[model samples]
Target: MIKMRNVTKYYPNHSEPALAEINVDVEKGEFIFLVGPSGSGKTTFIRLLLREILPTTGEIYVAGIDVLHLRPWKVPYLRRNIGCVFQDFKLLPNKTAEENVAFALEVLGRSQHVIREQVPEILKLVGLESQGHKFPSELSGGEQQRISIARALVNHPPILLADEPTGNLDPATSLELMALFDRINKMGTTVLVATHNREMVDSMRKRVIALENGRIVRDQVRGVYGYED
Candidate 1:
C-alpha cells in the first residue's frame, strides 16, 4: 500500500510548487490511473513515491517504509519493492531482450541460474518468448516496451509504476499493452499508471485520480479521463 498526506514539493526559484497539498492512499492489488496534461504533477507524483525528491512538507509511506526518513543506503531496498516503466523503452541497445531483463536481477546480485530461469519466463509472460534473442533495435516499438515492462516485473515487485507508458505506441499497440497491464494487475500486483490517454482511461474505468496545478482535483473509484486539455 501507499500513503501520502499533506504533501507539497517546491523547487528553488520557482514561483509555484511542482506538487501541492496532495493526499493519496492506494490499497494493495488495485489498478489506478493518474490522468492529467503535461506539468500537472503526474511525474512529480511518481518521483515522490520513488523518493527521487523529497516533499518540502508532508509524510510518505510506501510499502510500509517511511520514505522521507529512510537512509541513503536503504533507498535501493525501497526501490526493490516497486517496478517502474517509462515512456521511453530505456533498453540497453547492446543486450538482447533476455539479457536486458536479466541485467535487472543481476544488479541485485542474483545468481546466473536464477537469472536464466527468470529471464525466459518473463519474456514469455510478456509474449516475447521467441524474440528473446533479438536486440532492442530488432524489435518493434511495442515489443521494446514490453521488454521494458518484463524487466520491471521480472523481480515480482509488489507495486508497478508506469509514467506515460503508452505515449509512443499506436492505438492498437497501446491497448495491447494496457491489456497486459490489466493481466498483471489481476495477478495481484498493484498497478499505478500515469498517462493522459483519454481513450485508454475511459475504457479501463478503473480508479482515476486527476491532478492539475499540482493539486488533486478528483478521485473516482471508477472514472474516465475527463479533462479536455
Candidate 2:
C-alpha cells in the first residue's frame, strides 16, 4: 500500500517541481505500471517512496508509515518493508548468486541459519535454484536480473518497486522477467514498475499511471500504453 497526497517535489534552485500535485493510492497485492517519457518524474516517484529524497511539499505514506516525516535514522526501518530492483542489476561481481541474495539478509543481521534457509528458497522462487553457485559474470542478463529479484524478495518485503527492470534485456527476456513479477505479485507482494517498454505495458494490461511534465496525466485500470512512440 502506497498513498501520496498533493505531493510535489522541487529540486534546489530549479524553476519547476520534479513532481507536482500527484495523488495516488496503491492497494495491497496490486500490480501497477508507471509509464512515462524521459524527465517525466517516474524515477522521482520511486525515490519518494523509498525516501531517497524528501518531497518539498505534501504527504507520502507507504504501508501506513508517514514517509515524509520519518526520521533519517528510521529510514532503514522503512526500507526493510520495501524491496527494490533496478535496471543495473546491482549484483556484487565477486559473489555467487546465493551470496548476493544472502548478503541482503546478512546486512540486516539475520542469523546464519535463517540466511541459509531463505536464500535457496528465494532463488528457487525466482527460477534460479540451480544457478545459485554461479557468479554474476557467468549468468545471462535475465539470470542476473533474476538474482537481483531474488535478493530483493529474500526478505519477503510487502511492497516491490522496480525501475526500468527490463531496460537492458531483449523482448523475450523482458517477457520472462514480467512473468516473474506477476508470480511475485500473486504471492501477495504489491508490485510497482516504472518502465518505458510500450509493448510490455500494453501486453500486461495492468493498472497504468501515466506521467508528463511532473504530473499524473492518466490513471487507468487495465490500460494500454497510450502514448505515441
- How do all models score by TM-score? 0.99, 0.98
lDDT of 1 at 221: 100
> Which residue pairs does candidate 1 place in steric collision?
none
Q: 1-229, model 2: which lDDT tens digit per residue?
A: 8999999999999999999999999999999999999999999999999999999999999998999889999999999999999999999999999999999999999999999899989988988899999999999999999999999999999999999999999999999999999999999999999999998999998999999999999999999889997
Model 1 global lDDT (CA atoms, 0 to 1): 0.96
For model 1 the TM-score comes to 0.99
* Local error of candidate 1 at residue 204 (angstroms): 0.5
Candidate 2: where is the Cα deviation over 4 Å? none
Worst 10 residues of 1 by lDDT: 220-229
Q: What is the C-alpha lDDT of each candidate?
A: 0.96, 0.95
Which pairs of residues have clashing backbones in candidate 2?
Answer: none
